[model samples]
Target: MQISIIHEREVWDRFIDQSPGGTIFHKWDFLKTVEKHLGYKLLPYGFYVTDEILCAIPLFYKNIRGVKMLFSPPPQSGIPYLGFVLSRNCMNMKLSKKSQRMYEMGKVFSDEVDSLSPNYVSISLTPFITDVRPFKWNGFMIDPLYTFYFDLEQSLEDICNGFNTSKRTAVKKMDKYNMKLVESKDVKQFYNSSVDRYREQGLTFPIVSIAYLEELCQLYPCHIKVYSIMDADDNMVGGVLASEHRKVTMWIGSVKPSVKAPVNEFLFWEFIKKSKSEGYQELEMGGADVPRLCAFKSQFNPDMYVNYRIYKKDLIGSMAEWFYLNVHRKKKA
Candidate 1:
């Protein structure tokens, strides 16, 4: 079959929407939005077609060190966990002996990525195993970073049933406090309060600035959202900002001290309920701070697994990036 490089906006999105693991992140509009707002160089994407469009890797072309390569874009440069986004369909294609046709799809895209003449291509996948293998096959390195997810496909009763006693208690306490989740477009109060809370607790936040959030909101207006919880007095008690990627929605949460409420728990349930109502199948809690984050997320009855980040550098750029990280870490320490 012939593989064609598709540059037309409509053409790329049509294939993305139908791909096996198609996700919101891989959507043409989302990618374009990100590129337009964030100004990162995205890869040159193409379609792999035999009988039909089996798969496509949304990529952008880049030249680093006199070498050209195709990769997914604009994850913070020093961050270990950033990569190109892919649809769920292309990601879940099973690699079986009889699956020559399916395998060819990845091969074609892989060839295209390698042909970009860059040192490497980076792709990001959700925490599910069923969504990871496609990139692993194409010689793109894999690093399994652990993340947490909750499936909202079950009824609230079924979800609560899977929760351990401690988590159940947290949920009950949250409910008893009369805290309620509030959805709003108010950016200033949420952003300022969250930053203040982080500092008050002597914690370091790794999130981007409010300006970035504003840019993101404008870029993918429907995909990125902010939700908050307030007490009877209408004071913000807890909040979360989330992004929708394909069938899954993940959020970051924060709480204020005056609320004396189980705001975090309330926010978690709120995001889940909202996600499910919006027809999303899963809610991601994103990566946690090891045992602590994992333990807190466990209350939601999620599938916990390590999401790996694979790294390969041609010796030179690898060392530079590593040093940059180490220097910054040392300064922080």
Candidate 2:
């Protein structure tokens, strides 16, 4: 087995879709797209078994003061929640007991980090496994992460029944609003409108940008879609921007606050129905922080899980560098 760095766009694109948790966003082109649109530097890591490619890691290198650190893509603008994405296949390959694969995979990644001259390495967004302690290195640590998942495999009857009676009643009341859900490829209009809504609520938009989303649309044409709820007046009231990679369809939703509307409920119901009709295995509503948002997501009866904020020595120093940039250097975020 060998590890290699890929700089070409096409090679990374082909490799990304083949990985177990592959998605277009993990492609090298996404890095270029983000660089062009949002100016973030993303490096790529490719693992190979003899001549066959096994897994890819989308990573970036950053220097904080005198210490060097490698991490997943950083938050664009003020948006938070950045994660290091790896193909689930990579995890499976790493954890396989048959060939002592997990140990080998860990060695390969850890060695690669050392070669890059980083003091420590970190991985985020990993599902909790019972035996990660066996995969540790001298300076590395694995921490459990929690994530919420809404099951789409169950019958709609089951999901609808699981909701609180009052929430279910609210969804039913949305029927009187005469809402229609439509799928669209127009990401710019949706992005702009959503940003405007966020600004009105004094919230920073958590999206990349129009150009970057356009690149993602081209990369995952069928998987990336905007589901919008239009009112009887032919205006979009509520909508969600979603990306389907592997079996997970994630939430990226916003609504017009001008009207006291049921758009959120209508949009979610439509999205759920669409997921069921399209045969998606699950719909990930994304993690929530606010109590109201958490409660709202809970209304859907998703399994509650927490995503960890793990840090290695070098990585935490990298964060300290960021703090210095803002505190001492006086850089605005």
Candidate 3:
């Protein structure tokens, strides 16, 4: 096995499309947009056997306070998980053989990353790629994260029935408001609402820019949809921006603080119904680290999946972490 820089767009995206673990975050255009908007230097790598690509990982290099760091799907891009994308050929292999192959690929990937000699390295793997033992064995730290997923294969009634009573009640109450959900091209409104929500809580604004969202929406029209939840007066009270890649549709959205009409419940229910109608097999609600957010998302009765945040640090990386924990991160907290 050998590692090489993957420069060909068609080659990179074809593998991503065929990989079961690939999400929209792994797409070539998405990475290119992130690079153009966020100024992160792309350093995508691939593992190969002779002439065929076996696995690939997308990475972005950035200098933070003069400390060079590497990230996969980087911060503030609204991408939840993106690490390694393996070829579908691996899926048909025996379990033991597949594990061995993955272990080998992991080692190669680790070696390739180590060669860059960055101060810090961090990446979050997709939920489908559960084997992080190889990375751990290669001297990387691993942190487990969680995300919620709804099986859209079930009937709409069955999916609705799976929601907890609180969510059902909320939906019923939301119905009383006679809210209307309209698919809109208003990315600015969505961005402003999200920023307001963060500010109201004394939190930092999201890392990705409104321009990035707009470009992404335009780049993948069929894959991305922005819906506005309007009141009787046609005022935008809540909104959701959903992105679909293959069989999965993910919710990336926000709601107005003054609007207490359970717009989120209504918006999500509408999103789910639309996804089912469009033949999507799953709906991923993204991750909720905060207790309140988790509680609200859990009411939908979605299955829980674990994602891994793998990291490695050198001396400068250690100092960076110390500064983050003691100074930078504390200010945000």
Candidate 4:
């Protein structure tokens, strides 16, 4: 197997759709969006055997203050996961062949990344990837992170039954308010609300900028939508700007509400029903790492998933990371 910098956009996006771990964030446009926003050049590395591509890594690279660093989605970009994606051909291979291929791809990917001689590297693989042993044997450390996935294949009522009593009651209470959940193009409002929500909580919003958010929606409007709840008076009470790829993801917009109600719960329940109606069978409920968030997310009884944050760093890189986490990030807060 050989590693090459892939140049075909259409082919790559199609490959992403066919992969089990792929999401809209893995699309070429999204990669460009991240590069444009984060100022990191993307290295679209693909692993191939002869002419057939088996897997690819959408890695981002940057040299900051003499330290070469690598990231998949880039930290604080609000992307939950973005790492290597296996092609459909690889994914469809028989168990024996697939197992061998996984190890080969892992080694090849690790060797190529190591060749870059990065001072620091961070890769957060999607939950569907399932195995990190290949990278584990290649001098990388894995930190287990988590996300929740609510199954949407069940009947709407049955899915609702998974919700706890309080969540169900909140949905019912919001229903009495006669609010309607409609898909809108008002992304500006949603992004501003998200930033305000973070400020209100004395924390920095994960998103880098509004331009990044707007560009992503503009590039794939069909894959993204602002599902807003509007009150009888035509006021946008609360909403969630979700993305529809293989799964309906509650991306952003579950923020501070203008009204005294469980707006987030209402949006989540409505989003699930709307997604189910649209024939999506899964919902990526985002990260479950925060204790405060886990409380609310667990109310829906979603299945748990673990994604690994794999990394390697030299002494200088470790110092930079320490300062970033302990000093810079805290200063921003």
Candidate 5:
């Protein structure tokens, strides 16, 4: 197998569409947006056997002082997962054959990543790609992470049946207030609310520039939508940012309203119905890792899915990760 940096946007995007684990985050424009806003170099890698593609991954290459680093779906980007996605043919292989192909792909990719000589490396694989033994064998530490998912195959009534009593009540109370949900292009307002929410809880919102938010809306006008909750007086109180695909995702939810109302719950209820109405097979409501978030997300009674984050660090790389968590995070996104 040969691993090469693929620069063709159409090729990369098409491959991502063909792979089961791939999300919009792995697509050409999204990575380019991250590179533009985060100032990290985006490297799109395609693993091939002779003339056929096997799998592909996106890595963001960055340098801090003198240490080089490589990360897929880099930390604090609020990107849930972005590693490699195998071809449909590879995914459909018989068990033993698939496992062997995965091993080979992993070995070749791991060796190629090593050849890049990054002092630090990190990767987050989507839940659909569960084989991490190859990375483990290649000397990377593997840790489990989780995300919440709702299977939208069920009817809306059945889907809501899983919600706890309070969540159900919250969903019902939106009508009492005569509130309405309006899809808008006001990403700046959404970014401000998100920033304020994060700051209120002493956590920084990952993307600092509102331009980044604007650019995403510009790039994916149809795929990404922001729904704002408006009052009887037409005041925007709460909203949600979501991206549509085979599986829809709740990317950002506005803070709770200043006045007493079920803002978040109402937004989710409407969004879920919309996603289901649009015929998406699933809904990904990630970011339940934080205790408070986990508590709230649990009320929706979503099933848990496992993903893995693989990391390796030399001494300086280890120190860099430490400082990044302990110090740098306190100052900037």
Candidate 6:
């Protein structure tokens, strides 16, 4: 097998659409928009055998303070999972053959990533690829991260039954507030609310620019939905923005720090109902790395899935990481 850089948009997108492991983040348009708005250099790689493509990994190269780093799906772009999209043909193979093919593919992908000679390489693989032994063998440091998901295939009553009593009570209390959910085109409201939430927590907001959100919403209107929660007095109390791809929805949301009502719970309940009505099979409620966030999201009783962050670094990258962790992060603290 040989690994090469693939430049054809059609070929890349075709593979992504065919791969069960693919998400909207792996799409050509989404990555291209991220590149244009976030200023990351795109370098998409494909592992092939002769003329047939076996797997593809999208990457972005960036120079931070003169240190070259490569990221899959890039950081702060609102992309959660993106490492490699394997071919669907692998599903047809026997378990042994499939493992062997994946191992070979991982080796080739690792070699191609190394060829770029970036000081640091970091990627977060999607949940579908359970085996990381191949990449681990290639010397990448792995860390486990987690996200929560709701299966929409079950009856809505059954789904809600899994929710903790607190969540159900919050939803039930929504009627007293006279809250209304309005789908809107404005992303700045959500962005500002998110910033306010971060500020209230004494943390820096880590989202991409509002202009990027606007562009993404415009670029993929059918895939992206932004909704604002309004009180009876017509004030925006909370909002959420979510994107759908292949029957799964990933969300970003915020609620007003001043409002005392359960606006977030209402917003999510409405969104989940809408998603089910629209025929989506699952709703991924993004990550739960923070304790507060995990506790809040756990009330909904979504199943947890682990995501892996794999890293490879050179000597310069090690120094950079240390500085960022000890010096820069300390200063922020």
| TM-score, cand. 4 vs. native | 0.95
Worst 10 residues of 1 by lDDT: 76-85
lDDT of 5 at 119: 87
At residue 46, give the lDDT of candidate 2. 72
Residues 1-333 of candidate 5: C-alpha lDDT, one tens digit per residue: 788989899998899898887888887998999998887899898889887888998999999799899999876566778898889989899999988888888788778878888989989889988889888887889989999888888888887888999998777676888888899888988888878877877778876478877888899888888888898899888877888866788886655566687777887788788888888888888866767778888999988898899988999998998898889998764
lDDT score of residue 37 within candidate 2:
69
Task: For candidate 6, write residues 203-239 as lDDT tens digits.
Answer: 6566568888888888788888788888999998888
lDDT of candidate 4 vs native? 0.84
Please, what are the lDDT tens digits per residue for candidate 4 over residues 115-201?
Answer: 999999999988768778888888889999998887888887887788899877776677577778888888888788777777778
Q: All candidates' lDDT scores?
A: 0.59, 0.62, 0.82, 0.84, 0.84, 0.82
lDDT of 1 by residue, 1-333 (tens): 356656778867776665544555666666665555445566545544444554455555555555443445444321223333334554555656315544554566567555555554455543333334555676657766666777778887787778778667787677567677776788777778876776775553444456666666676667777777878778778777777766545545454354556677777767767778988777777646456566667666687656555433566546545654677544532
**Better lDDT candidate (1, 3):** 3
Instruction: Write one digit per residue (lDDT tens) for candidate 3, span 1-333.
Output: 898889999999999998887778889998999999988998778888889888888999999778888998787787887888888988667899988988898788788887788899989888778888898988889999898878888887887888899887786676579888898899998888877877777665555689999999999998887888889999988877887778655556654356768877887788788778988888888656667678778888888788889999889999987897688745863
Q: State the number of backbone clashes in model 3.
A: 0
How far in Å is the alpha carbon of 241 misplaced in model 5? Answer: 1.5
Error of 6 at 240 (Å): 1.4
Tens digits of per-residue lDDT, candidate 2, 82-123, equal 333444455565335523654565678767777778643445
Clashes of each: 29, 3, 0, 0, 0, 0
Worst 10 residues of 6 by lDDT: 248-257
Q: In model 2, what lDDT does residue 141 have?
A: 65
Q: What's each prediction's TM-score?
A: 0.76, 0.79, 0.94, 0.95, 0.95, 0.93
Better of 3 and 4 by TM-score: 4
Query: Model 2 residue 139 lDDT?
Result: 48
lDDT of 3 at 40: 94
What clash count does candidate 4 reach?
0
lDDT minimum window of 10 residues, candidate 4: 253-262
